[model samples]
Target: MKPVRRRIRRHFGLTAKQVAVRSKRPWYFQWGITVLYVVFGYGIAYWQFAGAEDVHQKLRQTALENQTLHTKIIQVERQLQIEQAAQTNLAQQLNKVQDENMHIKQDLVFYKNITNAKRLAK
Candidate 1:
């Protein structure tokens, strides 16, 4: 009784030491919650980094494919231009050959008339 009086007097009329009145979680439970938070943070970070790398890889692949297609288009255009020039040259040659053929025919007819006239005179 004297000890209780001394404690009450020392604490200003209350108990000298504090005691928990409510239930608390165990130490292991608190540690488990902390570990779960850390693991969750690491998982989210890994996902972010991996997703960025995947996007970069896809972009590089697309760029490479586009470059290949562009090169093919340029080659085809050059071939088409070359074919068109060749066709034009052939058309010019054909026109020159037709003119020469007509001239030759006229000469043949003139020679025939001269020979017939000479025979008539004889």
Candidate 2:
């Protein structure tokens, strides 16, 4: 293993002492980088998850509103249908009354003719 390392160092034109010194960074620098990565990664993760939660809440609220509006629309449509039926019934009643009125007017004209004829004959 030592011979292999020496051969690798020779190939890279590095002394064993220099390789050892360059391989190990200062303890503080290593710890500082680790701490920074942990803090930044946690912050990013928290922000993403929180934002997703907010979006999910908004979606739920919108869905509820949409459902409510749909129910209201259905209710309005049902009421409109009932009103239309009532209007149709009223129109039929009006037509029947008008027909009755026409018949009464014709009977009145017939009675007037009969009375006038009898008076003229007398």
Residue 99 CA error for candidate 2 (Å)? 0.6
- Pull out the clashing pairs in model 1: none
Candidate 2: stretches off by over 4 Å: 1-46
User: Tens digit of lDDT per residue, candidate 2, span 1-122?
Assistant: 99998888876764544434457889999999999999999999999998998999999999999999999999999999999999999999999999999999999999999999999999
| Candidate 2 CA-lDDT value | 0.94
| Candidate 1 Cα misplacement greater than 4 A, ranges | 1-52
Global lDDT of each candidate: 0.94, 0.94
User: What lDDT is obtained when candidate 1 is compared to the true structure?
Assistant: 0.94
* Root-mean-square deviation of Cα positions for candidate 1 versus the true structure, in angstroms: 14.4
TM-score for candidate 2: 0.60
Worst 10 residues of 2 by lDDT: 13-22
Local error of candidate 1 at residue 78 (angstroms): 1.1
